[model samples]
Target chain A: MSATLAVAAAQAKTKTSNYARIYWPFVVPAGLLVFAIIIAPWVFTLIMSVHEWKVGEDPAFVGLENYIRLFNDSRFQWAILRTVYFTTLAVLFPMVLGIAAAVCFHKNFPFRGLARTIFILPMMATPVAVALVWTMMFHPQLGVLNYLLTSIGLPASEWSYNAVSVIPTLVLVETWQWTPLVMLIVLGGLASLPQDPYEAAKLDGASSWQMFRHITLPLVWPHIIVALVIRTIDALKAFDTIFVISNGGPGTASETLNIFLYQTAFAYYNMGYASAITVVFFILIMLVSLVLFSARQKTTFQ
Target chain B: MKMRGLPGKIGFALSVFALISPAILVFLWMLSLAFKNEVDNTAFPPVFIPNPPTLDNFRAVFEKNNFFHYAWNSIIVSFTATGLALLLGVPAGFGIAKSKASKAAALIMIARVTPGLSYLIPLFLIFQWLGLTGTLTPIIITHLVITVPIVVWVMIGFFEGLPAELEEAALVDGATIWQAFRFVALPLARPGVTVAMILSFIFSWNNFIFGVVLAGRTTRTLPVAVYNVLTFEQISWGPLAAAALLVTAPVLLLTLLMQKEIVAGLTAGGVKGG
Candidate 1:
């Protein structure tokens, strides 16, 4: 009986090893690529951040100096504030519009499918191309947007060209592109909801707004949170559209942390400073993710 | 369900139309600007239609730049990156799914969450040192940073949804794990593969930041080329809109052709940033 028990243990070990041999071979290649391509560069960025390095100069170790300067820099402070400001507007507008759109489309209507397809087109088009076309449309004189505003008895205003309105204008473009993404996600959530509660609510003669608020919204809250998290991350790292439309123009009014980092690294060739900024930017993203995900967990339990 | 009157139905339709018309009009506006000549493009009333739409803008776009060359570059970069991503991600996804390795999946998510610039700055210096900048290789490799995670994440969900019985049957029938995967699992995963391939291709093709930094003048992709047009050509609305349209045309065509698959791919990873 003891020998039999020993044999059983040996067989279990071999079986596990065999499984490992099969699966590890499959996983290792991708793991290596992830490490080499994604992981290594981040490690390098972290290492570079501690030094006082520039393009065409020798790197000198200056632990925390770049970060020290970063916190004190007014421009960096404003960039952080602008990033938060832009991200809040970008995420909020889309969530509101997307939830509204998803709810509207959830009810049966003529050409609903066609409308969804049309709505997602902006999300599909390349950001650079979209930005260029929007820049054209946002033209103060000859652009269609101002023309429409004027024809509607509203005064034409500088869209992205003005300093004060630059971030909001950029957020408008961001909202236009991303609302469909949020809509689609929320639509998926809505489609999966059980019908019993909604049926009971209808039997109770609840108003549509009440039903949506109490039933649909709670049921779809997880999906909304997911969309919120995705949009926040995307908006935080928004580079292509802003780079094309304003490129942090009107004297850097639209320059978020991303644009500032890009200018520091590429335009100014301040690699060390940029690396420090990258570290901060990454931490900010992670922090937001943690907060949003905790909210997601709470929603899941309720 | 309560029956609606004709007035109610019409109102519903009109509201839906109002909701979607902005999306339609933006694309239509881009289209109008693309086909019109400079005169009509910048007209005071903002011409919604061209009385005599001409191909001159398209012709000028082609003439002013090496548009075909850039298009070819985009094709090469996008396809190779996506193909390589499939090669790496699909099997890894299968392995992780089969093993229930939640940790590995989380690692891939981390890669997706990290900003592109974080990887890009260091890679830029290294590529320059390795004398690999200005080549398609670095762009293709960096694009894997985008494409691989997408493929892996999508495939993990897909493989998890797949039943394990068939693979187990293959294994019991004197087949090795690889054989079971190749014959039973991969064949069953065609739809997932298609979705992953298309999404990865579209994303890689549409990427601007990678090409803007890594691609040289001769190796510029279409997005980067369109950007160059913006910077160099003084923003000629006719030609500029035409160029923008040209860059977006392939993606728009792909989206139209594969809308269902694209939507599935998107909502499949409903939690991730597209």
Candidate 2:
């Protein structure tokens, strides 16, 4: 055993040395591409954020003025508020619906595969197309949504047009498009869960809800947190659906940080100010992600 | 609350359908819109199905704009990006898997998480400086920001799932490292390759922001075409929905066909990220 272990150790050393030469070649191409394409530009964004730059003018260094200006920019402030509101609300429905659906599909049931296949389609379809479809459905007079509402003995209001109801309306669309993704993530966890604990709980005469609430939910907490992190990030980054549907419409009522940043950079030609927003955006994402990660770690080890 | 036997089965199926029907109903509505005429499209008591369904809306979208041209640009950009991503990503995945290269993996994941707008700003200026704006080249290159990481990350999952003994056995049989990867690992990863290829293609095809920032009038992709139809032309629901469907139909079909693999691919990233 000792001799074999020594041979294995020697083999590992040689293999690692070979890797030192070979691995760099294999990794460098992809590394260089990502660095050149993503990382380098990100660094440039940081640099550009500090400079007073605009189109057709030479850039002059402006220190922390742009960053400081962001605090006083009301539109940017509203954009941040709208973004938080959108992400928080958008993530809730999908988690609840997705978990319920996952629970439904977790056990053996008739036509479960077919049901899941149908359920997953919405998340798979193109976002742009999904946006347009929902936009047409949200139409006030000729929309199917209003038709369905009135058929149910409920009054119909302007869907995306009403500033008061716009975020909820958009959240409905978001939930429609993304609940399947959450279901997909959670279903993966459900499929792999051990049956032993479930059987033990059943032996104790635990009710189904009790079994789920105690055994299943604890085991699935990590997976749920993963879904939460991904959903939060995607929700924060949401652009295509909003861009196509409202274009941040109804008088900046729905304009999120992404829209504000885009307009500041491209429309208003305030590159420096936009870059400052980008930096803050990055910081916000990192902080939220760190919190989520630490939470996931706690749940996973427990 | 447990309904045993037949009633329970029925209830489960009913609940599933209730949860899923919104997506189905909306799709049916989209199809109805795409097949209706302008009069019936805007008609109150909105036509659930077009009476005497017309192909004129599809024809109008195709004729009024160069739909095929935009589709061509989409095909070119996605094909180049996905193909390049695969070529670069597979070996990178293998190397990272074997080396336990966590930093490399994290580096690639940055491209995945960084907002496209951040890259859009500087790359737009850089492409302009290089005089490469208004062409397909920049669009294809920028799409790498989406494709390469997807390919690398997905492929890493596949390669890592593979047992090390297979490669060791090949090496024992007098195969070189290159031959072992080529003969043993590559063949085993064919399914992973297929998933990565399809996903990268579909995502690149679906991308709108890059094309919006980079493409000239004649160089736009299909999603942009859908947007232009909404903005530049009249809001004829029939033609608008038709363009939207045409843009998504290919990917939607592929997703339906490969639901299981796609789910696995998507969740693998999430699990690994966790």
* Highest-scoring model, TM-score: 1
Model 1 agreement with the true structure over A80-183: per-residue lDDT tens digits: 99999999999999999899888877787666666788888888888899899899989999989999999999999899999988899999999999898898
> Which candidate wins on lDDT?
1
TM-score of each: 0.96, 0.95
Model 2 agreement with the true structure over A1-302: per-residue lDDT tens digits: 99999999998988778755655667778888988889889999999999998966888999999999999988888999999999999999999999998888776766677777788778778888989999888988888889889989999979898898888888998899889878878888888888899788778888888878888888888889988888888788788888888889888989999888888888887787888989899888878888998988765533
Interface RMSD of each candidate, angstroms, one decimal: 1.6, 1.9
lDDT at residue B211 of model 1 (Cα atoms): 84
- Report the lDDT tens digits of candidate 1 across residue range B180-252: 8899999999999999998899888889988887889888999999998555765688888888888898888
- What is the C-alpha DockQ of each candidate? 0.70, 0.65
Q: Which TM-score value belongs to model 2?
A: 0.95
- Model 1 RMSD in Å is 1.8
List ranges where model 2 is wrong by over 4 Å: A1-12, A15-21, A299-302, B1-3, B271-274
